[model samples]
Target: MKRYWKYIRPYLGAFILAPILMLTEVFGEILLPRLTSMIINNGVLERNEAYIVKMGIIMVLIAVIMAIGGIGAAYYSAKASISFSTDLRKDVFHKVQEFSFKNIDDFSTGSLVTRLTNDIQQIQNVVMLTLRMMFRAPGMLIGGLIMAYLMNRQLVSILLVVIPVLVILIAIILVVAFPRFEVMQKKIDRLNSGVQEALTNVRVIKSFVRETHEEEKFKTTNRDLKEGSLNAMKVVITAMPLMMLMMNITTIAVVWYGGNLIIAGRMPVGDLTAFTIYIVQILMSLMMLSMVFLQASRAMASLKRVKEVLDTEIDLTDEQASEKSAQIAAGKVEFKNVCFQYTKGTEDLVLDHINFTANPGETIGIIGATGSGKTSLVQLIPRLYDADEGEVLVDGINVKDYSIRNLREGVGMVLQKNVLFSGTIEENLRWGNETAGMDEIILMSESAQAHGFITSFKDGYDTDLGQGGSNVSGGQKQRLCIARTLLKKPKILILDDSTSAVDTATEARIRQSFTTTLKNTTKFIIAQRIGSVEYADKIIVLDEGKIAGIGTHQELMETCEAYQEIYYSQKDREKEAGA
Candidate 1:
């Protein structure tokens, strides 16, 4: 709660003013009943027309004042609450943006989305109610009780018994309902997860003819959510009626006892009437108090969830970078006895004591079977995940020594899974180099072998792609991704199986363009096809977590057993296909 004060501080004036104005409305309500009692005794019963009209005018003035105060309270409360929630949501989103890969792994996407949207909304509602009702309810209750005692001290004794009973009931409701609200939030998270997954994988679900299975899975989560909500609400549903029953019973006792007092000449009819109104005021205020407490209990749970995101320590930072660190002007990279594990403190090593070097302007090919840590190895180049044990160097300086922004800017990586957001082709390309112009975009597209197909579209560069480039073929999407990376014109380019979707002929053309045009850029290509890396300056054969061999393609084919086995398998498959 203290952490969130910054958002509310800017609206402090509105926050303070709302409750103060609401108090005026409470005062008016308390005074109105007393004015009614005076009009009944001194004006109506005495048959004084002048007195009745004067008291009636006073009642009208009080009502007008209460209306104005209520409107002011509402306006200020709404302004403060809405602005606070907007700022809080923005901060939560910014914190999410700062999260490292490891940080994101700690919270699911669905859970984060729920916290941002629904949880913040819950807190907003509670804050608005706090400003408007938290003070007014208590003020009205106390004022009405005092006025009732002044009217007839004996008649108010009935409330002493009923108020204690209502307090006990509210306490019991809190004890039973708090834990259920927490569980209900978790159920909401599960429902959101199921919906998100089903939507994202709709194509796969349809192709597998699993609509019935998906429907059943959704039904299970939806039913759980419904049950949880019902259980949480059951406490409120039961408590409200019990409270009303107690209120009605207390009103009956007040009427029966007060009527006898009036008939016996011990009490005035006006005092009895005012005492009844005060009883209603006190009981209604207690009900409002219980409702506010219930809302606040749920909001406490939401506050904790939002605080979790804000407080998580980012795992990766660039605090150690200095001004004097060497720039990666020429693409040169090396790994020295590097060992890494995705899970910290785990004995399992994904890359074990691997050592390799690539000089400026050299093209290197890395080959291995699946799960040989191919993607993990290249990720270290840009410091996406730091190597657990050894140094990763760029431009002959430790990668850690350079600022993260500077280091990543010098290295362009086309990840294994290519993604394009919804936008014109030109807009997506600008993400790589914001300042890129028409000629530069056309040049990079041509180099990537994507220009020929792009021009076929009626809109050309202005063509809009669907989410994740769903409208394009796998090959076209891959080429467009490569073209986007080319716009960066980094010193080092890492293509991790980015060409696997394209045919061998188109792949050959792309590599040829890279060789001729990007002569000074160091390139690292990870591929399963031997033919893809046959013309490389060097080839690395990895077996398990170790580097089995590194040499020119012909040299590796002759001297490395792992390389020889892979080559023969590909040759045999090619011969069978040809036959």
Candidate 2:
């Protein structure tokens, strides 16, 4: 509630004015029935022509005023609601941006998208309804009942039965509708997830000829969404018909009783006519009130979902760092007695009892069999995931001590899966250092061995990439990513099998450039191919999340069994290829 007020406070004027203006419309509406009763009783029945003209003109003027008020109400309500949702959407998006990997893992991609869009939209709708109806509905109900009393006091008895029944029906509908709406929102998340996955991996789906499989998955989610929506709306749908039935019954009863009163000369015909319309207006206002409550109930479900994201405690934050000004320099990295798990309080550790040190300017190679915790080890350096047991240090300071931005800015990493946004090639490369000039951009591209193919494109550096760089080959994508990271010129660099798609000749050229141009940068090379990391200053071989060996090529060849096995297997493969 407090968090939402921040957004509301800015547009408080519009919020307050909307309902206030609506009262003018409601006031005019209430007076119309009373004015009609007078026009009939004093003018038509008594045969007074000027009196009829005067009252009719007054009614028209009141209607004109009512229309102006309604237009003003609508304008303010729309302004308040749109502005409120815009700010709320922005904050929700910012909060998601601040979420740690673990916090993000707790909510799926599709769920976040729904919360940012559909959930906030629901809240906005409620705000618009509330702003318009807050005063209008109640004003009409109270004014209508009062005028009805003046017209015929005996007619008020009918409301005692009708109001309570409609209120009870509305309450029952809301109670059932709220939970179903929540379930419906979750179904929307599934639908969105299915669609996003299919579109993003459409290439994979086509290559494997699994379009039918994807369609089936979409159909299941789509069907679930349809059923969920119907369940939610079903109760809300019942409200209108039940209210209309009661409305008709109450109208008939009022006319039946009031008609008798007119025949007995206890009430005037104009009074009976006015009384019937007042009953309808009163019932209509109740219906409007019920609609407002129903919408509010649905918006509450969305609010809860939105709150989950806003209230999420990001497990990773640098708020308590001792050295706020700490920055990474010299690039010395060490892991001491480090233990980790993707899930905490579990015996199944991803990396166990890990211990290693890489001095500044040394090229450290990390080779491991699949699922040997290669990526997990390097991720700790940037504090992507905190160590469950021990500390990860950079330049002698705990990685946690340095601010995340400071530590990350000094360490550049190219993960196994390369990602590129939809933009020109030059715009993509500038992500490393936005201030970098064209000369620096070309220099890094040459070092990554990407300049050759990049220039061959018609637009060269200005060539626009498709989403996720789909237009480029796998090898070209890797080289572009390499160049992008290189432009950072960080003290520490990690290339996690980033060159796997590039041929050995180009890969070697990139590595060679590192020694000459980036001699001072400590580089961590993670690869499956032995030759990729064979000539490093130090090679660390991992097996089942443990360091099997840590030494240069010849040193590991003699001392480590795991290292010997890997070397012989690769040498045999090379021999076969040679033949």
Candidate 3:
């Protein structure tokens, strides 16, 4: 919570001004009762009509002042709270973006979304309430007690007893409810996760006809959240009623004792009336204070949740040493005895001591059985995850020596999972190079075999794509993703089974375009289809985490048993189709 104050610092003027206005408003409220008592005892009791009119006008003037103070406080508090929340949300978003893949994996996507949206909202509400009520409530509670005592100390004795009991009740509620609020937030995170998963995989659920099963899963999570919320509410509800009973009992004692005092000529009737109003104000103030603590407890829980993400140190940071390495020519990659494991104490290595190199203008193909570490090997070149041992070099320098932006810019990759945003075809293409002209977009789209379909649309380049490119076919989405990568015209292009969705004719055309249009760019192709890599300058076959063979397709077919098996399997499938 203290860490979040950096965002509030910019709006300090508003934060300070609001409390000042609120204090003035509380002063006005405290003064009004005293004025009422004077009017009753001096003017009304004497039946002086002139005095009554004068007091009435004074009361109206005070009321107007109070209204102005309230408005000023509200305006300042609202401005500060909203500005603080906006800055906080933006900071959290940027921090999340800077997080490494490992850091991102530590928190689920849905949980991050919850922290960004729901958790921030909870904190903002608490800040707003605190600004508006925190100072006012305390002033009212203390001021009301002092006024009541001064009016008639004999009746004020009830408060000394009542206040302690109310404090104890609030303390007990906080002790029990604070822990539950934290648990309730966790339950909300789980519920959000369930909803996000259902929405992301809605198509799979429909295809499997598992709507009923999904609904049951969602209901179970929803019920957990409901139970947690209700339990917290029940505790809060129990405390409020008990608090009201205590306040009412105190009020009754004050009235009964004061009436006897007035009858016995020990106290004035006007004083007794003022004392009752003071007692009511004190109780209301205490109630407001109790509610503030309750809300603050919940906000504390949300604050901790948001801080977790913000405090996460980015595992990958640009190194000063990387600056000298950027001067080297791009597309010179080297893997020297590289090894990797996702977690500590894991015996399995995703990539073993593998040595390889691909120079400028050269194409390298990686062929492997499922789980053979092909993707993991390439991921190291960009420093997505540092190798546990050995070095990954780009442009003849250790990748860690290059700035993250420079390293990524030099190497453009089309991931195995093709992703497209909700935008026009041209807008998606611009993601690769924001300043790319229309001619560049057309040339790149055509090279990736996506231009034809894009032009086929009524709006051509301006056609809006649905979220995740749901409006297009899988093949079209893959081509659009490829074109997006091509627009960058990166020095080293990595295609991780990017052409798997396209037909053989389209795939061949893309390959031809790469040889022609992308003559200067070094390409790393990871493909399961043997035909996809047959034309590569060199093909490396991976078995488990080690390199089984490294050569052209014809060389691997004859020299490597694993490669021979893959070749024969592909040939056999083609023969069956021919027959």
Identify the candidate with maximal lDDT.
Answer: 2
Residues 1-579 of candidate 1 have per-residue lDDT tens digits of: 587789989999999989999988999989988988888899989999999999999899999999999999999999999999999999999999978777888998889989999899989999999899967889988999999988888878899999999999898888888888888888898889899989877888999999999999999999999999999999889988998999999999999999999999998788888889989999999999888888887887888889899999987778876633456899899999999988889888999999999998999999999999888899999888888999998888888888877888889999998989999888888888989989999999999999999999999999999777877888998999999999998899999999999999999999999976688999999999999998899898888888999999989978999999999999999999999
Model 2 spans with C-alpha error above 4 angstroms? 577-579
lDDT of 3 by residue, 426-445 (tens): 88999999999899889999
Candidates ranked by lDDT: 2, 1, 3
- lDDT winner between 1 and 3, please give it: 1
Candidate 1 ranges with C-alpha deviation above 4 Å? 323-327
TM-score of each: 0.95, 0.98, 0.97
What are the root-mean-square deviations of the candidates from the true structure over C-alphas? 2.0, 1.3, 1.4
lDDT of 3 at 161: 84
RMSD to native, candidate 2 = 1.3
Candidate 2 least-lDDT 10 residues: 148-157
Candidate 3: RMSD to truth: 1.4
Greater-lDDT candidate between 1 and 2: 2
